[model samples]
Target chain A: MTALARALITLAVPVLLVLLAVLAVPADGPTCLGIGLRIWALFACAPATSAWLWWRQRAVPA
Target chain B: MIAAFVAVMALSLLIALWARRGAGQGPRAFFVAGGQLGAILFFFLSVGETYSIATMLGFPGGVYAGGEGFVVWFFGYILLAAPVLAVLGPWIWRAGNLYGAVTIPDFFAAHFNSRLLERVIALGAIALLVPIGTMQFAGIRLVLGALAPGLPMPLLLAGAGLVVMAYVALAGLRAAAFVAVLKDALMLGAILLVGALALLHWPIATTPVATATMAAQVPVTLPFALSTIAVQALGFAMIPQNWAFLFAARGPQAIVRAQAAAPLYMVMFPLLMAVAVFARRMGLPVDKPDFVFLAAAQHLLPGWALGVVMAAVVLAGMVILSSVCLAIAPLLTRNVLPGLDGRAQQRWAQGVTALFIALSAAGAMAQVPLLAMLNTVFYFGIVQTLPGFLAALWTGRVRAGGVLAGMAVAALAIIGVRLAGISAGGINPGLIGLILNSVVLTLVTLMFPRRDGHSVMAMLR
Candidate 1:
């Protein structure tokens, strides 16, 4: 993918995760459950971010 | 337990000194660790700022004392800000590298070619950092007091401050980064262990497991949560120490790789919440709300493990305090006192680091009302520099005069809002100040665009 394409994916990744979070995690759930879901969501978002960054690193090599 | 705590503290100092063995010489070497930190050191250092004593104790304590709502903004800010850093951090590295900048003031002054603006940022940064350095001591007092109830709080804090000063004096940023690797490992282990224990021994709950994250009586209102997250997430990008850490990176890619992993580190938060709930469930005597995490861990862990946990907490505070001292040292010697050569700068750095520690310790000991208020506004005030920094990085259209004027109006706006005693319904006042600052800055720049014909973006490219 092009750099612009990768940038767009990086931008889009958060929105998609938010959408999935809304579907998977209940906002008004139990505190522990809510915390768990958020962590789960974070797990989802964080690794995805790393993958995106790793891909972007190739285009702009060190 | 006492032996364990002492050993951990010694290890932290040893790692810091170890970082300086065979290290390059001169002010830059000391300040930015010779600007050759690989991805691992940069990752540890950058993430170090996120998991401070505040996270270890304050996160759980806030939840145990207040409600789970406390985690919303705290976790939100950390989780959301990673991407922002991942995007902006490399760019910040680019800016810092373009001008060989060690401090934010150094970057601003070099980019704008304005000594007066440098002074403004340097003074503002020092004022902003005052509360932050002291807050670490506040945590130190709380953690050490819990561990060794026999030890005097004042003496413990003073000693912790001295040790942090020693770290700065020893290797500057490299010392902080090297020690950060140990602090992070121990902190993460402690949190995960205590949290897991809390889960394994989950008590029958009087209340439901699904306690609401945003309770009606909770102080962390929805507007406040959303607004604080937004403002702080952006402001997190603008923090001075983070900049210093990023500048230590070998290049922009190191920043990219390091910050990319920062968000994943927040995996510790859920466990933090678990530990908080554990404290509440067992009806632990949380006389001081901030001690809830330590109280729970003390209840769960055996002597040696407790020692390791306490050491982690203390070292968490020390690493951050050392980073703040590092940030301030350069501001004082390099930007604030620009005439010092390498030898003179290092000499002044030691004295300045010691003086800063002394003053911060004095203020923390006194608990002056004004210092407390400054703590409240530090984040808001710190971000006021963001506009000017962005202008310097992305365009030459911005003038030092414009940046200065915007920051002045923003500071006054925040002061006014505070004096009026308005919460804006839990919204952060600094966000308001930042908006007004941006508008004023835009108008001033438009009305009087620069004729210097220098393009910062072009130069960087």
Candidate 2:
């Protein structure tokens, strides 16, 4: 991956995770299923981001 | 419960003996565990740190006592510090592999070419690590006191102390690693089972009510809760002791995978958050906020299940922390002290580690709040190193003088401010030191003439 691409992806992954966490926990509220869903979302991002990064980096010389 | 305690300690002793049988003797055996950890063991070891009694107890209490602000900082700032490891761990491993440096202070000496700096860092780390060591003693006693409240506190602490010292002295980091696997598993299983059962008695919808009821019960806002997650995340991945395990990772790729896999540990936080929230919603008295995890399990689950969960939480507290302190004290002794040959140094390292633990245990028994004291020291000491280490890797021109100078200034500021009882708002004073350290490093590097790359690398050694 190009330098810019790697940097952006690296930055975005954490930001996305943090944003999802904020949205997951209720604001002035409690949501049981929402909490579970938010955690699931956080977990899903890891494999998804890893795959995307891996596939993108494949074009570079190994 | 007593039987369960005996079983866990017996199993730990057996593992310690097994690990020692093939393990090399002295500091190499004690400090790095022969530096042969693979991805699987490394993963558990790293995650076991994430599952400290602080997280199991202190974090949820923050969420319970404070409101959403604690939640945001708790979970959010963790992501702030992880990218640091992505860069720092690889270089540390490579350098350690090249130089055969087993401890962070050794790495400091190698990187800065200064024995004095290495000693300072080691001293800072030991002072910082005292809180963690104290917490371990307190955590084990808390567990013992609960399981058998009739047992005298000193006797309970002594019993746990004997177990911790025995395993650490006999087996070293391998014992900690072996126990980490069981600790994390026990923690995971117990929290999940208890969380699920807690939901049965106290619906998730009523969590806020529970939280509100418990809030009125606290004497003050939890002292260290607000910035803990950030402080923890930043320092957690960076501590010379824990990060030494990064050196033991099989290679750069294993380090990357461990870094990548680290976020998964974040999922457990919410489970802990749920328990604290549910317990509060149920109007449970969290007089000792540290006991919230155990209290939740006892209140929510069946007798047998509670027994199992309590044993797990207590064991997790004892084994994982003992492992960390075991490595930390020895690392301090070996790297900080100068003019010693390898063989002699190794023996001295073991002696120092034992002394460090003994002092820490004594402090905890004197009624110092272990969790708070440990966090304050750890956050201050480890965060200062972040800039020096990070700049050395990512920025080629970062002078050794600049890094050293920044660390000195930052250390002074933090110590000075702390002695004055002035905090830097919610952010840790250590982090403030880190900022100064980074700025000085960047500015100094930009201003100064670049040294020859070969000489710089040589100086780094």
Candidate 3:
């Protein structure tokens, strides 16, 4: 993939994860699991996305 | 409590004096700590500035009044913003180093070759920052008044402002950096202790279970939560004070390490949110939502513990207030009055710092709005600059004229919408302004593309 494409993908992953969590998690009812899922996705996705972007930038020639 | 307050303030002053030692004299030392901060100092400084009185007082108060839904979006935005920072912060640091930029507008002016744009941005930043400083002033008053019932509010406000100005004017960013170490340690300890005590005293249910059930009952809609998180996360990333901290890093690598470690520090928020919920369950009488954290401490903890927590909260306010003042000083000395010599600029910065603090203290005394509302106004205004900043950072296609035009339109739109008191279907005004700003920017850029041969990122590299 091109560098721009890689950067776009890197940005998209976190936003996509957050959107999924926001939409899938019910506002009412047994939300312990839902809240946990949202929090976990955020915690996991941010660092994961950062690492991916960093590695991609390194792998590609500037 | 008063004795504890006196000791903390004395120690903070000594730390400021120590930070001043060996630091050379000039705008560079005062504004950017002579660019000597290492990874650990950078980490503490960035986290310390990021989690201010807002985190300690305003946040739990939000959770207390609004319920667990507040925590969801609050942490959501904060968590999501970090990765973006991890990517962009290093670039900002590089640009600042390359251009010898002390403020956000300095970077913009140097990159765009437009002194006019720099002045406009500086004016916009000052306008936004003063209200934020006012919010911090109000927060200090709230925590102090709750902790010491007999103390005079105006006297406390003036004293807090003076102390903050003294450290910031004496040692500049170093004062904030060193004080941050103590503030963060005290803040974290106090938060954990409060959380644990609240849980112990009012063990109604497991934390998750209680918070989840509270989340269900609150009126926070999904749309509101999602939009709030999106706009606030972007705003947080682009706030001027945060950008200054980014520029102060020793190198891009230091910023990366700091960004990676920041979320770990935010684990305190959830613990504090639990404390707020516990306060609610325990039938605490909180007239003002912002008092929830202090109220919990007052009602639940021992006198000595309450004193320590009060000191921590006060330190949080002072450290951030000092940083905000320092952030604004550069805009005045460097951008607004660009004709001054180095010595004159430093002198004028100190003068401007004192004047700005006085204005904010006066606004805080008026107390026309609540603390959180003042903060929201700041966020709404600052994020309007993001389109301009991103264009400058990422592309050569967008011109300075286009960016400024977009920002102007967005600012007017924000003011109009806010004044109308329209919610726009649960969307935040900042997000709306950002969307409109980007659209205008794209249209204007297509009409008047930059003739520069290289992208800003490439040129900087």
Candidate 4:
């Protein structure tokens, strides 16, 4: 993959996850559930993506 | 409360003095802790600087005023920022190490070999950051005045300024780092204690989990929240002070480790917002929404615990203020006024820190907007530099001319939109400016591509 493509993916993946989390929030259900989903996306999913990217970068020879 | 404040301030000063012990006398040590900060110290410093009075006071106040929506997006954005930092931080550190760069402009100067570009960036940084320092002072005054009404406001502001300036001048980033450990501890303790009390004393629910949903009283549109999260997270990583911290790391790996662990510290925010939501339910009488955290603490905890909470809040403000003052002073002395000798530059930085702190204190005395609003304006200005910085990192296409033009265009757009009160479908002005900044940067770079491959690109490899 090109560097530009890789950069785009790196930026897009977290944003996509956040967007999906926001979309999954029910309009009228328990607010705690919505809050939980948002927190999971930020604290869990986002960091996981970052760690994955870091690992990938490390795996590649400089 | 008074005794707790005094004790906390004394302890902070002692920590600052201790941090000053091994710090060598030089610009690098003063500005970047000699680029020798270990993982733990770097973690403390990064987290401490990022989560400031805004986290403790402004965040809770936002929840209190606007409901869970205000804080939920912030959480998302901050979490997202960590990963970006994790990826880019090491590269920045590498560049800094390669060039012996201390400030953001130092990186630009060495990379592009353009002192003119360095001075422009420095001037922009100083112009943008002085208001932010003033905002910190305003936040400190609010926290102190809410907790200890008996203390004189002017004296409190002056003292706060003096203490922070002394520590920053004496130990620089080391002082901010060491003091951050104490600030984070107190801040975490205070947040947990208040959150637990709020959960326990929740009148509406039989269990703590049931009360979590009660905080989502106000409805937030999905578009606004998502856009906010996107822009804010990006802006957070781009802030010049944050960049300085990246440079101060022992290595790229330390930054990644620190970024990974920083999220754990942020768990306190959701709990704090829950407390704020609970306070709103109880109809806590607060004239300002930012006072929700303090008001709830006063109502729920005993005087001693409230004192601890106040100390945490106040110290968070001071640590951030000190770090910011340290960050900008070097930009002023080293880049903006490059005529000074090494020793003279250090002296000038110290003097500038004190002067800036005093000026910020005086500004804080005048009535300003809420913490969150001031923060928005600050981020709007700072994030304009993002396109250029990213272009520098990713591609060798962009030049100093393109960067300067992008910045000028973005600044004008931000000011024009803000002054005219133009709303782009509820999108943040900063995001708008950043979009324009990227466009201008790309167009200009494509128009005037560099023939020579910069050495900075080789450093990145």
Q: Which candidate number maximizes lDDT?
A: 1
State each model's CA lDDT, in order: 0.77, 0.64, 0.75, 0.76
TM-score of 3: 0.90
What is every candidate's C-alpha DockQ against the true complex, given to 2 decimals? 0.37, 0.26, 0.25, 0.30
lDDT per residue as tens, model 2, B199-307: 6666544434443434522232223333454455667666766666776667766666666666555566667877886777666766666677778877776666666
Off by over 4 Å in 1: A1-26, A30-58, B207-218, B341-344, B367-376
lDDT of 3: 0.75
A26, model 4: CA deviation in Å?
1.7
- Give the candidate order by descending TM-score: 1, 4, 3, 2
Q: Of the candidates shown, which would achieve the greatest DockQ relative to the real structure?
A: 1
The Cα error of candidate 2 at residue B89, in Å, is 1.9
lDDT of 2 by residue, A1-62 (tens): 54435645664666566566556544544455234444445435544544443443343221
Cα lDDT tens digits, model 4, B1-461, are 77877888899999999998888767788788888888898999886744678788777776666644665576677767776776667767777888888888888887777888899888878877878888888888887787667979999888888899878866889998999999988888888888888888775732232343334333445556667676777777766778778877878778877776665566676677778777777777776777888888989988877887888888888888888888888888878888898778778887888888887888788865544566677777777777877788777767888888888898899889889988778777778788888999899989998776454555556
Candidate 1 Cα RMSD (Å) = 3.4
Worst 10 residues of 3 chain B by lDDT: B208-217
In model 3, what are the clashing residue pairs, if there are any? none
Candidate 2 recovers a fraction of native contacts equal to 0.12
What C-alpha lDDT, on a 0 to 100 scale, does residue A58 get in candidate 4? 58
Q: What's each prediction's TM-score?
A: 0.91, 0.84, 0.90, 0.90
Candidate 3 local lDDT, B1-461, one digit each (tens): 67777788789899998988777776777778887887788888886754778788767777666744566677677766765676667766777877888888998888788888899989988988888878778888787777667978888888898899888867889889999998888888888888888767864443332442233323555566777777777787677778778877787777766766665557666567777777776757676777778888888778777877888888888888898888998899889998898789778878888888888888888985655566667877778778877787678888888889898888888889989988788777778888999999999999999887355577866
- Cα lDDT for residue A34, candidate 2: 32
